[model samples]
Target chain A: MTEKDFELAGIRTVEEQPLRAKRKWYKEYPVVSMLFLGIMIVECFFCEQIMTVNPTYMDLEHCNVAPGRKFLFGTDTLGRDIFSMIWYGGRVSLLIGFVATAISTAIGVLFGAVSGVASPRADAFLMRAVEIVLSIPNLLMIVLLQAVLGGAGVIGISIVIGITGWMSIAKVVRTEVRQIRNSEYVIASKCMGGSFWHILWRHFLPNFWPSIMFMVVMNVRTAIVAESTLSFMGIGLPLEIVSWGSMLALSQQALMTGSWWMILIPGCFLIVTLMCVTDIGNSLRRDSNQRQSNL
Target chain B: MSEILIDVQNVTHHFKLNRKTAICAVDQVSFQIKKGEILGLVGESGAGKSTLARCIMNLYQPTAGRILYKGIDTCDRRQFKEHKKMLQTKRQLIFQDSTSSINQRMKAVDIIAEPLRINHVHTPRGSARAEAEFQLHYVGMDAGCLDKYPPELSGGERQRIAIARALSMEPELLVADEPIASLDVSIQAQIINLFKHLQKEHGFTFLFISHDLAMVEYLCDRVGVMYQGRLVELAPTRDLFSNPQHPYTRTLLSAIPLPDPKRERNRRKGVYDAQKS
Candidate 1:
């Protein structure tokens, strides 16, 4: 601070410091998220590999059976264990949700970032395209396209859901990227001689990542709901594999016979998964928003 | 004889306030800053002081006229990107609000290291860290604050880090535009002192822009009074204070509150409304 102070300190220029040690996500969310995710993962592994009973395998002897030692959620009319059916049904639907979300997010983010950073004319054109895509009724379009493909596989259904789901995400990303592009820090970065790409990649991407994370979780939930609706129409997944939507469809008739477990079991799994995704998305949104406003 | 370090020949910048009209933010402003001298630009909030600073920093290419830095044409529109890259590190601007100017996601150390890293002054990670720490100390900040983000630190700390960042380039010229405006009144004096000390040590041409005339008199060698995007008057600090010329400058000088109530009551009554023009 002074000549005397400088003489005492013996330091001149400030140096670039390495990134600080960061805490793991699990450490940050040790109680609820950790326990919940831990249980989900173990269940996934148990259903996928460890469970001896095949979800699709039917036994006549087990027909009309209720919840007992052998079958935890009771058996359906064709006599498949309700527990195994729900597990496998949930597995396929969750996988569809995740894959669909990934595809949509990838397309959306790329388009948004490009539109956000591009020339005004390009941005307008791209945004118009987004609006056009959004104008088409999502479920009706997916149903029509799937009807054309007829007997399309899970991958095809996922692609269909993703194609319809990305317009909103693109709009969100575009707005955020444009806002960050105009931020004072980005201007400051330019003043310091940082290239456009460097500023976008280094500064804008990290700032926009939290929003993207939140969007992805929300999109996954949307995708799952969309998948179930299509499958409920008997146009989504193959009838050979059990999905929550197909289970619900099959239980429609069974509901008349007073077999409530057929409808209730798979329905519970779907509700829980959607709730968990929403909770995660909300928390991520809060975490990001908190950094800006909270002390 | 003092050599001219910076020369501005009627620099003007216009902004499109709306679709129909273009407002002149810097209306043909012309002034020279001498080598190793602290030249202060004093004005009200919208008097275009910040615009003039940005023009000098070449952040905004002036609508007309040229700004020469050490005889190099800084506002040369020729070879656009090349000319900009050459002048960027040589001159730097420290903003008023570091919270908005700093990358909110970056650590204090990273913020300081940004200029150094980009300018290739320090390529290795270890040296960059050392340099950042040293700059923090230069700005009277402890190393413990280095790892914190801008949001995690106080306003003064963020400003210090911002200053440290600009200082890391070892700039030939520093245009600090109301750098202490957002800071506390108590901290304002300390930061002004720090700038003064740094100017003395670094011997860089400094442009200290502020509305605080008393502060300008204390820290500036020469002061330029800007009103409505125009530099109405310029003179040595002592000369400007003792023998004020412009009516606006006189009004500004009269507006300064004296510590003694009697002296303040006896102060000249001059209300220079900037909106009149």
Candidate 2:
């Protein structure tokens, strides 16, 4: 066979084999996977409908209407559909959470890999800088940045959360990189005259994935919660954006009037989404630990 | 005498801790492995034999001096890369702890084919499985082992696999760094015999570094004695054992318990003094 043909044949043979054995937990608790998948699908479908509803659209004729045929979740204080507001608000929250976390993780992985794999002098300098950033309270840093940026909109909040969220991920990645740098395969690669980028891409990055995954899962929840807090404090997004926190903020006056639907519906959706995300994260964490112990 | 294949000259390696404390791991160590000859390096725990082997392999950059392959410096990256195929095809290493050295995640076939893959030897003719199977059989393993992971094998099996992997590279010089140190006593003999057999059959030179003097004497043509990172004596295996010149070498040899129980019992009284001889 030709060289290219042989290489292709060899690669195909190797790739055909399964990389890891299927874990017992996955088989036993198939519902967990289904639940996570179902939630994701529902969230995706619902989020689009949320933006379509005019959260500020008032219907004086339908004001204070209880659960009825037209509005399943009933009308809010503003005469808007509570269900529609939730779909839109959840879209914003989920978007902010995922996008911000992704950006931070990418930054963290790059910084951490470079710092951990570089020489001692570079390592010390980078680690000290990481330490300084980590020492700052996350919420305060976000708030300070948000204030300086002069807006509490989606873009501003995302930027603030993304920048500050990376510190924790960077620390985790740095620790993992330091440990993997000394592995035999890495040393072997060096002996084979492999370049630094080659070593980083081939060896360090693959091994760094499990931790990065864990960090992403954990950071999503943090970003979501931070965004909610900023929004609740009247500093995130425009007043028109119908977020859960904005709904809560709007409900404070209506709570005394016994219009409980204003707060309870959005609040429940937020709680459920957070809980499901946390469950998935916890499962991933358990899987990671099991894999490590097996190793 | 066979032509000199590897010349390690005045190589000194020190592990520096801050400015004040520096531990000299290999101090001006020098040796040569002739083509198609087995040269054993025997020493105690802190003897720097492994460090010397690592320096020769260019895994650890030496603090001073040179390691030459066919009289050309092996330390230059450009020269090393230019002769990459020669280096990968001509030199291989068998580590002390075979299980730890081989990537546990990789299958037996992949582990054996690693050097070939890295050196791009199998690129043009990528029959890694065929080559791997051949080497595995050479070391008494079958194609069935190709699918197995490192953790699935016994210590002896792992070492055998390690040896097969090293030999598969078609190395002219094999650095067996305490290849049997982690194996059982019964298994050690089998591995030692395998090394000897492979050397004879393949006509490959060997630099066997080990703490076991007896094993070294049994397998090597020439033996070198190392103490505190320095080679104090070098000669033919039998000659070095019978007429050791260095005090450390004499102490080391004298401390080896004789096989006979009666001789061992009688020598027990002088054993400690022998260790200090």
Candidate 3:
């Protein structure tokens, strides 16, 4: 125990080596998805400059033209450039996805937070209502609501999808909020006399935000899919207003004439965008699960 | 005699599992804490020590009886509302686990300043941050930990931050529910000493709940022993150690292991018989 015994033992201090923080490059950041999504957004943003011809300008002479250097992605049945149409319609598709997701996430977060903080009886009633809404198929509800709303424009379809899509996110958020509401920090904040809004903003949001994020991104994909499905059924936005959905809707005539590019190009774009979105959402869910397990 | 700061009269709490079943956690427990004294509550796990503490902190409304803080009935909603600010600012709680007690996303300084911000207590120490820094130093922590989050700190450091946060409000009564239970032995002693020193200097009432009998003996002005949701013995620290009244108290006292090997070899562990008692 003494210094003399230590000297006899020949104990020496080694300089401690600092560990470099392990940067989880793959799991922490979905680089490939982000890059793809970014490129898509940029391409849509510069649609006007990138298009070689007007997206909606119909030329009778070039009807049913096959894909060639003169007409990239070929001309559709009405002779509009499919390449230009994809970019132009992409803007509307992404816009619908984002706006619809925003609306649904907002409604869902608000509903879930209220349910989580409500009394047991009120919470039960609210959750039962959500369950009832969830019992119906999402696509059926969206389609029914879209039909009722008359599918007037992009905004109308977005609203219809948003209203129908919020049930799932609300359920997810309510579970997260219920779990977080019991956490000691939230209780401590309450004991300190923090108001409901104060606790929600300062404590609850930070604790439950990661869990809600995955559902939000997934909602975006769901919204886009809903728009496409409605349009494919010939009940979505009018054909005059160009969107990926409306483009696909117009492909019915192209299908009869054997113009394959009309159906193939738009479907690929939609599927790729959806896959990237799903990948990002999966990564976020993984990140949140890891965080919860660590805790 | 010192004036009583907290008065619990026949307080009882029950957790209802279903329509036909309920678990009585605290059964008609009554106790009084005087001003500026450290009262220790000790019992085995599941003995309703935490339930009693929560009831006292107004975190749970007892199924029966009531608690009075400075002659104000805290259970009454109207009375609590009337004195909400004073009740909130004048009392604070330190939970057993600092990891969950403190917000992980917040900085140490912000955690310490939160109560002040919430209660709108004008910081006579200039700013809330300055007051927080003063409290940190008072709890024997350096200003270097000001910006660090709870996850970045060690166990002892996190507990210290939790202590600093509770002390920042300068509450008249601080209820620490097994504050040292999750800490290492060495850190436990350090925190115990810190509590002792702080009590002597600040002259604030404390309700310290712990299962460590030796610690209760060393640091408390008085000790209350609990068993099976009931108070078995309550007495001065010296009297309780010198002469325990209840059979359960004797059993608890006898369970403290001695440091001397020869004497420890001859030590007999006492067992309690519920039927006989």
Candidate 4:
């Protein structure tokens, strides 16, 4: 505002001014990342409609075909349509990513909130438990758990990843809750007879949502990588399930036959999805920080 | 001779720094605030004025002694739990810094109605928002600012909102801890006048803590002078200002600057050595 504008207007008039110029949603958010994620979701949701050939249909005649007009992403050693596999596999990947992240984030938030509000001794015990869980290598635990359960499916692997992934998120939430618990506004709420749930809903959730979102996005990337790692080792979802990880499981044969498309195409899809999620998470964190600083 | 609304008895609060040492923020201070009376507490910075106010508000559990409000010992956990609703509703606190006191993300109306909504207090005006609007106008604030956040408003306006929130509960006892310290000099006078009007019109009891001696002298009925966490003198505002007893109180009185240039030039500053005392 200029000095002349201030001279003409009163303090109330100045305060009434809009904080910033309004922008369209596209302008406000990361457009490219949002578009990519939206497309991925829509494409994966209609995989059956979009695929011309079954993902598991093996043609013995055309084996190890390179990128050609007949096959969008070429053919694997099994002669399966790589394009169909990518779409079909995408559904499982996205579902597992989202479901696992949701489970882990929920568990983490619960633990963190409880630990934050718990008494000193209880808090200490909870934090120690989290630390112990975090100290163990998650992959080994998942493998052991998968064996104990006899076999693994989409839900099974998601649950395994979720249970093991919550420790770091719990630690982050604990730190955030502890910091916010002592803020004057929170104390004011408490003094006004606001209950714990009320405070958590009104104050805790809104304040720490951005950080948790970032963690959730990062965890999705971890989950996808973990699934791929397990599949490559021949321990993940059975051969019947055509996930991107399962598609990549034939990498050894593809490498020996010099059919690079088998490994490269699926790897590109995974990387692109991970990058899109990371970009979206970064934008969210930035937006929240800017809002706080503006205040 | 009036009924004592708040009786603070031998209250002492200390913060443990470590296993070996502790800092006594509030010494064995005792005082009684009568119904419909304004008790102003004045002291230098770090004199435990704010700490004492927090103790009275039940924000801090005093290490020793007790505080009684309406014949119920607030210090006792069971008694506090038994009278939780009444205690929470009837006693409201206004913090020193309005910036930190009100949630920055919440609108003015929400901040004001929070106490009412939390306690589920039915207002004559039908809704909590209506009561909040009434309280805002009661504190001399315009209703136009009701939807604005704390950051959008100026310091004085934020403080007004804080005061409005406190008054929304129709609190019998209002504790203001340096409420005007962060405001401009002009706004400070306006807030002080608003406080005076509220006390007179509502007959509300006040425990006003401030570093502004001139304001306390103008606003309070009884004034208590605290020196290093100990209230050295408790007397009527006029008596304490004119015929001060404690050396620290005299020194504190002399520290107030005069408006007249000649008088200010001739003023003799009083000094008291803490070591010798």
Alpha-carbon runs more than 4 Å astray in model 4: A1-29, A48-85, A116-125, A250-264, A285-295, B121-131, B273-277
Question: Model 3, B37-78: lDDT tens per residue?
Answer: 899999999999999999987899999998999999998889
Would you estimate the TM-scores of all the predictions?
A: 0.78, 0.78, 0.84, 0.85
lDDT of 2 by residue, A214-246 (tens): 668878888888888877777776658767777
Q: Please give me the total number of clashing residue pairs in predicted model 1.
A: 15
Candidate 2 has a DockQ of: 0.15
For residue A7, model 1's alpha carbon misses the true position, in angstroms, by 64
- Of the candidates shown, which would achieve the greatest TM-score relative to the real structure? 4
Ten-residue stretch with the least lDDT total in model 2 chain B: B268-277
Better of 2 and 4 by DockQ: 4
User: Listing candidates in order, what is each one's chain A TM-score?
Assistant: 0.81, 0.81, 0.88, 0.86
Q: After superposition, how far is residue A280 of candidate 1 from its true place, in Å?
A: 4.1
Name the regions of candidate 1 deviating beyond 4 angstroms: A1-38, A45-49, A53-89, A106-128, A144-157, A172-183, A194-215, A239-264, A280-295, B1-5, B18-20, B69-78, B103-106, B116-128, B242-251, B254-277
Against the native complex, each candidate's DockQ, computed on alpha carbons, is 0.45, 0.15, 0.50, 0.49
RMSD (CA, Å), candidate 2 to true, equals 12.3
Query: Which pairs of residues have clashing backbones in candidate 3?
Result: none
Relative to the unseen true structure, what is the C-alpha lDDT of residue A208 in candidate 3, on a scale of 0 to 100?
Answer: 76
DockQ of 4: 0.49
